[model samples]
Target chain A: MVEQALENAIPGDWRVNERLKEAAIYSLAAGGKRLRPIFVLAAAEAVHGDEKAASLAMPFAVAVEMVHTYSLIHDDLPAMDNDDYRRGIPTNHKVFGEATAILAGDGLLTHAFYVASEAAAIGVPAERTLAVVRDLARLAGFPGMVGGQADDMEGAQGITSIDQLEHIHLHKTSDLIAFSLRAGGHAAGATDRQLEALARFGTNVGLAFQIQDDILDITGDQDKLGKPVGSDERQGKVTYPYLIGLEQSRRRVEELTEQAISAVRSAELADSGRLEQIAMRLISRDN
Target chain B: MVEQALENAIPGDWRVNERLKEAAIYSLAAGGKRLRPIFVLAAAEAVHGDEKAASLAMPFAVAVEMVHTYSLIHDDLPAMDNDDYRRGIPTNHKVFGEATAILAGDGLLTHAFYVASEAAAIGVPAERTLAVVRDLARLAGFPGMVGGQADDMEGAQGITSIDQLEHIHLHKTSDLIAFSLRAGGHAAGATDRQLEALARFGTNVGLAFQIQDDILDITGDQDKLGKPVGSDERQGKVTYPYLIGLEQSRRRVEELTEQAISAVRSAELADSGRLEQIAMRLISRDN
Candidate 1:
């Protein structure tokens, strides 16, 4: 579904400036799970609104992904994580050179907002667009993802508690996901109560997703994951599985997954059944 | 004057969380010539608009300065430029350590747009607010400042031509100034022609400022400059002075200053006199 949405969102006029056009396509085409946009689309659909409202969410969805990608690129720099592989391919700095990769990441992240603002101006109502912009700014700003990153950088040097770990994951991962859900709901003119429920749902799912990732990093097959296993351990970084035993972490994932479903179900959204199904599928996925 | 503007712009009710407030104040209250905001105010005044109209431009002006400061912080990182001083004091990383400095830079940059958007929402019409957002987006994006940084990074490893040097300076320095001027005019509801003239004036001055900087780096007193002399040469970086010699660079500055003055004069604005005077003063500045 996201693949289709991305294809539709990217125009087919290929005769423009080749450099920019190619860069945009190359970055977008280097695919990830499209988790952010899917959450957006699902949340909008859960409110019994036109799927077309998802169109309003695309630029932000793309922007969030770009920011995420840029962070990964920088993290892989020699000054940071220094990883050589990502998604089974040479990291951006490896393929494009450190300078180009850095600029490419910067370009993508900056352009993301531009793209989002253009969409907001044309498609969403003024007030709603303003709200979307606010939500995104908060999600990407000091108290959200960047703050989380700062904490991660600092925390990596010392021991940390489960609560602190949760704080980091909430900001680093869940904030953007929550924005995705809220933005979709806003686009669909969802009620305040509905938006709150979507936020709750997104937070729970996001936590569950991170916990599952912890489990995978510790025990999952490297071949299946397409990245080194035990890297967190190697780096002395804390994770859910490390703080709470793996068994407990797995149990926590189940608990969070159930809470996520309960939040969505309790909302009594008329069209929420598919989203619930997807949430269940996500928590149970193997690879 | 800039201090008064900043004091007014920053929220006085510190009733919120103390730490976040402190962080904001500590960074913002650090001293520098608030050239960007001055440009904003001057441009609005040139259009016969009240300060209220340019309030939207304040956050943007602040954001530009934050970006400039953040760049200084990061560029001073050991892996980057490795400078020890900025604004006559130890750089952020020097005082705060590498990790905190990195986070501070990231925090400042991300928070900049948040502040700008909030200001836009409050003081400007929705359509005009969108324009401010767009102008900021373009100024900070790859084709503008970041692209210039990329060019600078690449050029550092090799020699560059006068044209390439101009392009770098245009993107690195001029774009934000141009945005400030244009955004101020935008807030004042300047006609398209007036806005164009302001942009032209800004572009010329922006380039002239770089030429002046190049000359100062070579010829200015180390005591007054507040840093080591010949730093750019030490870094093996290219500059206008490096390429054209001091005499030719001075001539270029004069030419660009003339062009800027002419652009402002050509506008024939009812309230353009102050702006013209400021431009002239900026070019003739000795420091």
Candidate 2:
């Protein structure tokens, strides 16, 4: 359902500029784990204990995925990480050329809000939809993802401590993840206390996810990861494993996952089982 | 007031990434005409005939300017127009490396929606605010500016006619300008007829503004324009004068401006006088 929602989010044949649409759709369709959108749906389901409520969360889900995908496209630019491939396919700039890729990223980022505002049309309260729009921008924007990226690039030359690594990971990864979960809860009319629980759960899960990524970079199969390992070392990026060792990183992932599950469980949600299981699965996934 | 609002629009000391903030502010401060924001305010005042209501339009005004400024930053990138200078100063990428500039542009673009959502806190109806947010994204995203830019780049090889040039100008330039006008009208609680009139007026004025830019490139003072002249020829870009002859282009500008003024008059807004004057002045401006 999430996959189909994403597919239908952007028009395949916008008459204004087919190449721009094509470039944007290409990156979006390249397919990451779709973890962010799934998180949104799961959180919504947790709040209401019904699939229909989760369905209302689909717009937020698709919107978050678009934001994530656009960030990946920009992050891979020659001036940034300069990665030539992602998810076993050529990166956007590598495929569409740098200028078009940049614009495609812009299109996706801008259109994400259009998609999110769509919730109002689907019966979500206008006030909630507006709040979601604001939060999406705040989390996906400079205060969150963009700021973290800028800090990461600036500190790339010398990030020596676990604290620095954690700070970057929180803003770079956890903010959007937390937003995804919180948006779903908000859509389902979760109370302030329940929303806070989802945020805590999301932040822990996001950190665990990053730690697992660091671990996978050291020990995972190239075929499953779809990109070469050791890229952190190649890029001189300090990661959880680099700062705390592989064993400690693995332990941290488990701890964070457990904390995430506990937060979900304590929220008194209609059913926290799915969210708790997803947290566990995240830590165990190879990619 | 516009300048002060623009200054306050971004935090001077955001702790997350000060460098990124500086990069965005640098370009924003390297002043253009500030025409878009002024159009926003003028349209709002036209609807309600009061300065207080126009003040209420300030957030929308500032948001549109941020969008305009971001587009300029990205447009001047090495992969795009590749210009080293804008407004007689180093471009954003030139001043703050390409990577930071890219991130800064992304920051500005994403934060635009956040800024627009501020209208709600200032007492704009939630439904109206949501509509504005959606319109902002649609006019600024794939269906509008980004698509226009992609089309311009693809058609750069052989844009041989006035129709093609106008098409590019409408999307690339007119859409955002129209959005600025319409957003202001929406904020002022204008009727649908009034909003449509603002759109018509803005579209005509925007086209006239672009034509005047083309004319100024050939005939205006370099000091007045603040950048090199004849860049259109240098970039092999097709402009109004390039396709229609200088005399015809000048005549077309007058026609569009007249049409814009007529639109304002036809709306029978509470005060159409200022909007009409803005359109008339647009065609006659030196830069």
Candidate 3:
């Protein structure tokens, strides 16, 4: 369903510039876990397990994925992480030139808001819809993902403490992740208390997912990892494992996973089975 | 009013990463015409000369300038325009380096929406506010500015006719310009007729603005222009003068300016005096 929405996003008309379309679709079609959108769905389902709410949140599901894909494209640019590959294929900038890749990312970021604005079409109250849009913008912008990225870049060479690492991880990796559920809760008419629970759940799961990612850099196979191994240390990045040792970081991940499930349970989600499954799978998966 | 709003935008607190804030605020503080925000204010005035409307639109006025500044930062990047100077100072990327510059731009773009979402506090209806948000995203994103930029980059050596040049200018330059008025109209509760008139006026004025900009590149001095003169010709760009000759281009500017004035007159704006003055001044000004 998300795939169909993603495919239908870029206008297929002749006025649609083919190159821009191709570059955006290239990174998007590369395929990841699609966890962000799924989290949105699952959170909404937890509040009210109905087709209506899921349908209302569907466009935003695609929108968040688009935003996620754009971030990956920008992060892989030569001036940034300088990664040559992602998800087992050449990065967008490597495939298309840097300029086009940058523009494509910009295009996706803008289009996400355009898609999110359609909340009204699905009978979302305009006030709530506008709040959803505002939340996405605030949470995605300086106070959220972009700010976290700046911290990451600024801290690249410095020795970092657990606080600094978690700060970066929460914003860079977990802000949008947490918002995925918070926003879905908003869309599903979840009460403030319910939304808070999902936010806590998302935050914990996101941290665990990021910890696993850091762990993967140390242990995952090269071909399966789709990028270089030991890149965090190579890039002078202080990840969870490096700062606190592998054993403690592994334990922390397990704790975070448990906390995430507990959050869902406390929220009294009607159908948290999918969210639970995702959190567990993310923590334990090798790849 | 707009200048103060622009200056006051960035959070001065410690939470704002100083480096990123410096990069973004550096370019924003650089003096320009500040025309976009002014147009937004003026359009609201045209609809109704009310302090309430002006106050309601103020955040968006500042928001548009932020968006414009962010675009300039991105356009000046080494990977993009490669221009080292803007407004007689080193470009954001040149002063801060490329990666920080990119993040700064991302920060501003995201923050613009965050700021714009404040329309609710000012009491603009949610439906109109959402429409405003949608318009900005659509105009700034793929279908408008970004797509036009991609076109400009692709056609650098291939653009041949006045038609293609106008196509690029209308989307890249004029879309946001037109939206400035359309958005202000929404804020001020303009009738559909008034909004249409503002759209027409914006399109004409924006096209003329581009024409005059191209003319300045050919005729203005480097000291006053604050950019390299003859850059369009040097870069193999086909501008108004390159394709249609100086005399006809000048005539075309006159026509567009007159059409802009007539649009306001036909709309019977309550206070279009400022819009008229701006149209005349822009058409006649050397810098």
Q: Local distance difference test, per candidate?
A: 0.71, 0.90, 0.86
**Worst 10 contiguous positions by lDDT, candidate 2 chain A:** A10-19
Off by over 4 Å in 3: A221-229, A233-236, B12-14, B221-223
**Residue-wise C-alpha lDDT for candidate 1, range B83-198, written one tens digit per residue:** 77667767776666665665566555665666666755656666666666667766766677766776676676675589978987888789888888887777677788988998
Q: List the candidate 2 regions with Cα displacement exceeding 4 Å.
A: B11-14
RMSD of each: 3.6, 1.3, 1.8
| Residue A238 lDDT, candidate 1, scale 0-100 | 83
Q: For each candidate, what TM-score against the reference?
A: 0.88, 0.98, 0.96
Ranking by TM-score: 2, 3, 1
TM-score, prediction 1: 0.88
Backbone clashes under 3 angstroms, per model:
0, 0, 0
Real contacts retained, model 2: 0.90
Clashing pairs in 2: none
Show the lowest summed lDDT stretch of 10 residues, model 1 chain A: A13-22
TM-score result, candidate 3? 0.96
In model 3, residue pairs whose N, Cα or C atoms come closer than 3 Å (at least 3 residues apart or on different chains), thus clashing, are none
Model 3 Cα lDDT, one tens digit per residue, B1-287: 88788888865663767788888889889979998898998898888876567888887898888888988998888788899888888899888988899888888887888788788777989888888888888888888888888988888778888888898988889989998998898889888899899988988999999999889999888877767789888877788998998889999999999999999899977888888899999987777
Better of 1 and 3 by TM-score: 3
